[model samples]
Target: MAFLPTTKEEMQEQGYEQVDFIYVLGDAYVDHPSFGCAIITRTLQAFGYSCAILAQPDWHKDEEFLQFGTPRLGFLVSAGNIDSMVNHYSVNKRRRDQDAYSDDGIMGKRPDRPTIVYTQILKRLFPDVPVLIGGIEASLRRLAHYDYWDDKVRRSILIDSQADLLMFGMGENTIVEVADALNSGLAVQDICYIRGTVWKSKTLDMIVDDYILLPSYEQVRTDKRAYAKSFMIQYENQDAINSKMLIEAYEGWYVICNQPPLPLTQEQMDFTYSLPYERTFHPKYHYVPAIEEVQFSITSNRGCFGACAFCAITSHQGRVISTRSVESVVAEAKTITQMKNFKGYIHDVGGPSANFSRPACDKQQTHGACAKRQCLWPTPCPNLKVDHSHYVDMLDQVRALPNVKKVFIRSGIRYDYLMYDKDETFFDRLVQHHISGQLKVAPEHVSAPVLDKMGKPRKELYLRFVDRYYEKNKQFGKKQFLVPYLMSSHPGCDLNSAIELACYLKKIHHTPKQVQDFYPTPGTLATCMYYTGLDPRNMKPVYVAKTYEEKLEQRALMQFSYPKNYEIVYRALKKAHREDLIGNGPKCLIPKNKPKQNASFKQERAHRQKRYSKT
Candidate 1:
């Protein structure tokens, strides 16, 4: 019902001389469950701990972090909901102009690498206080991994940030357990046995559980093969039910990662969301751009089973599906209907994957996700459950609520998973009810070789889904269309593969308005491939589009219809020895001769060149 204290006066208003924890953030404060800071702080408050928010404090001034003085428990730090570097720079390494998490969509509100920066400031100001770091940035970088921004292998963030403890995964359970230990007078260094956490040690004598010793940092940093091998081991050990502790050696210390925290039960999931949240950004700011997309949206589930190679969700949230009850989801939707800004519309009602309302199979409950297999990748495993009845029922109850005119599912849906379901009831309802004129699904790429590296299904599967989608729309007399999300310049994507994608686009007579170049962020299988030119799953050489020109040409192939990209597409076709694609024929992606560039086209080209030239 009330926002957490953000200032000394508010701390006093809460009748606290000093708070237990100062939760530092790199984003503007928003008291919505969609934001991680809100959930963690509110969860702590629910456990009878007083916490304050220090949102986007000036890192240069030591006094800025000392606003609440030292806390009784310690400090909690997060680099917003995303990695600070990824939030600041695009895949091309060009600085972005707008930051959706900042006040009024402003840029440069927080320094780059805010976790390391903030931790260092806090450590310097209060040398004895403990600093616990988590979020997407720290969770993915908890081991020896490749950093695309640095273009080198970097040590674990716990080592780099010098934080006392690092909590990984969805840390609701992990945070509370850690808090209990600290409150019981345990030293940060000795609190190393908890699941879903990473800690440092001077020797391995303290490691009582069975653990796999990974290749040392020196080995992974110098040898790409060692890096790939190490990543595969870490990737396979993300399961809670069957994983062992992992240790990676450095010069004089070792970073130890415990097995992931177990997935929350349905009751626990509901209780976490049921906590009191103001559900908006702090009133001090006029507006926060990130809240607009999630204000009326509901998160019905957590974790993703679709272990895409380019995604880090599997590494962070784990592969087991954890969901809220249908009653909980309906309760939240009813709350949205009563808001002052309610427009009789609910924006989204899904999570990592919208339709994943239950575990992949009954076996996942007893045993964690298969270590050597993915639930829906290469092909849906024989044991895959492939049910959507619960999801359909949930949506039906939500839309039937009073004052709710429309409900849209904006989260990306795994089309391959949808196609696997034997029943067509969910598919038909999705097309007829949930779509907001256009539905977005990620096909990633069309080429078989590229799709293999991206961990996506074959193009035939997508084509089938597309055909069925159109059929459902026709049955309902609706004009909905599928907006397939495509990626370019991914690992294993050569010029020929790019040409193949262009030809496929020509066959469909569709062009994407915007295309995403594969971003090599930290701790993704795709990033390992981008850095080492080898797939971690199998130690096989893979084609990586690394050079600026090659990446540009690959991206141009996706938007071949643009006149400004005519030259780049032509060059790509010639480079691939596919000159047949250049002509007046219907299948040609470009013309034989260069097209005249208008002023706007020239300006856009010049701007792009200027932007990419920095990287």
Candidate 2:
């Protein structure tokens, strides 16, 4: 269980003349199973492939990449846990001051586009060596899509980076298969049949028949409608069983993405987590801030059935929920209690959605998710099963373990799904034990049209959840608050819709402390809408707040209680022809300050003119 070799000295000590794979990461090396890099490198080690870490290498030159003297198999590149662009910049396109994934939480350790930069560096240094890219950055940008920072349609990362292959989703199965094939002396270009991966082919002869050909890169780049159309096709084919081989044409090459790898079963999920992870950052690094949040947490499940338009979980983790058994989760919890800095508290016991320990329904396992229909949207499907007793039992078991003080569920859950369940046992216990005063929930928006476009349930559903949450709090005699996470300037949200949301916030007597302006990152349905100005589902025209000022105005309206935000909220209301909202009435968002301010300004100007005339 020694750490992977990161330096030439370590490699020499380990007698590794040439490692099988050299993983170049954007973030500091944290050899925990929660990190994709750790799981991938550990899996390779399990398969007897020697892997070394070249984490956060300086991209200015290729000298830093030669530390391992070229990997025998290939070079694995990832932008750490988050996309590099997202890790480096905020939604406003401003450089972030801190990167939690870095040692000491410093910024600028990695370039803005780390995967492309590192891949280019490796390719230049070692012309014969193959480069493979995965992780969130490469996965979401595996195909040609919108770049929020560049504000243009960029080509696939595989083309830009010239990497041999792009492993898209969770790459446990794909990376192992890739390592084995490369070990067997298979050429990188010829290893095209692996699932959950994208590879470049020069000719159509390599492409299998009956594949759904997406709109060419040239087509999507030039035509907005084509981009939206292409997104819809890509969206529907995310299921493993029902997915077809997707082919997209470039100028002289074709990017062929194989069907996604099958989801891990319960046993497989347990085995994946059972790896001998140090469960901490590499000891060489003095401090890794990102580990503070998840070091004590456990990921009980993966994937999400609640497919929100703004989220990429459905694309990245798939729609089917794969969970570890209760025994495995409890064992992990016990191991956490024995950690050096154990505080007797487990931060989280969930994944994409905490409460989603099971599939949406029984048919999802065998039939695949309904192509056109959603499990939780419009309304919870009649076939949707909403059992939570298994999750409750698991939580109870972990809480009762020796040396365990309290188990908390900090990861977010689907409030609507909780409401759908006829059994309220988990809901009751959640309020009683799990929460820490204020529970953060994402309602996103309150306007029906905006909610519908965002793939969220209607306002009434959230309201009911709110009522019950507070009622449960009252019953427990614990004064807890519901901190609703709201978003502004999402696709399909105009000034009118923003005003509607502002009015709703007024009725609730709650001003959000934070309001996120929708950032159109790659591979989300909302991002497609943001770039195309049309809903991919029906190709309907959707209102998008494309201007920086308009986005600011919408965000200001969400937290209009701040004195600095009054002017923007007032202007937004005026522009939307809702001058009625500018008064002293209860329904008014802001007072008619200009009415008195203009008169004072005229009087002061008259006095100044009279004084100037006398002088």
Give me candidate 1's TM-score against the actual structure: 0.98
lDDT of 1 by residue, 1-615 (tens): 789999988999988889989999999999999999998998888898889999999888888899898999899999999898988998878789889999999998899989999999999999999999999899999998888888899999999999999999999999999999999999988899899999999998877899999999999999999999999999899999989999999999999999999999999899889999999999999899999999999999989988888999889888999999999999999889999999999999999999898999999999888999988889889999989988999999999999999999998788999999899888988988899999999998889999999999999999999998898899999998888898999999998888888888888888989988999988789999999999989899999999999999988998898888988888888888888889999888888888887898789888888866774
Evaluated at residue 44, the lDDT of candidate 2 is 87
**Alpha-carbon TM-score of each model against the true structure:** 0.98, 0.95
Please give the CA lDDT of all the candidate structures. 0.92, 0.89
Model 1 C-alpha lDDT versus the unseen true structure:
0.92
- Candidate 1 local Cα displacement, residue 125, angstroms: 0.8
- Model 2 CA lDDT for position 279: 94
Per-residue C-alpha lDDT of model 2 across residues 1-615, encoded as one tens digit per residue? 798898989988998888999999999999887899999998888888998899998887567888789789899999999988888888977777789999999888899889999999888888899899999999898889999999999999999999999998888889999998999999998889899999998898856546999999999999999999999999999998888989899999999988888888999899889888999998888899999889999999999989799999888989999999999999899889999899889998989899998999999899888888899998888999998887998899999999888888888979999998889999998998888778988889988999999889999899999999999999989898888889999998988889999899888898887778898899999999999999999999999998889999999988776666778888888788999988899988888773333566568779877865664
For residue 385, model 2's alpha carbon misses the true position, in angstroms, by: 1.4
Residue 98 lDDT in candidate 2: 88
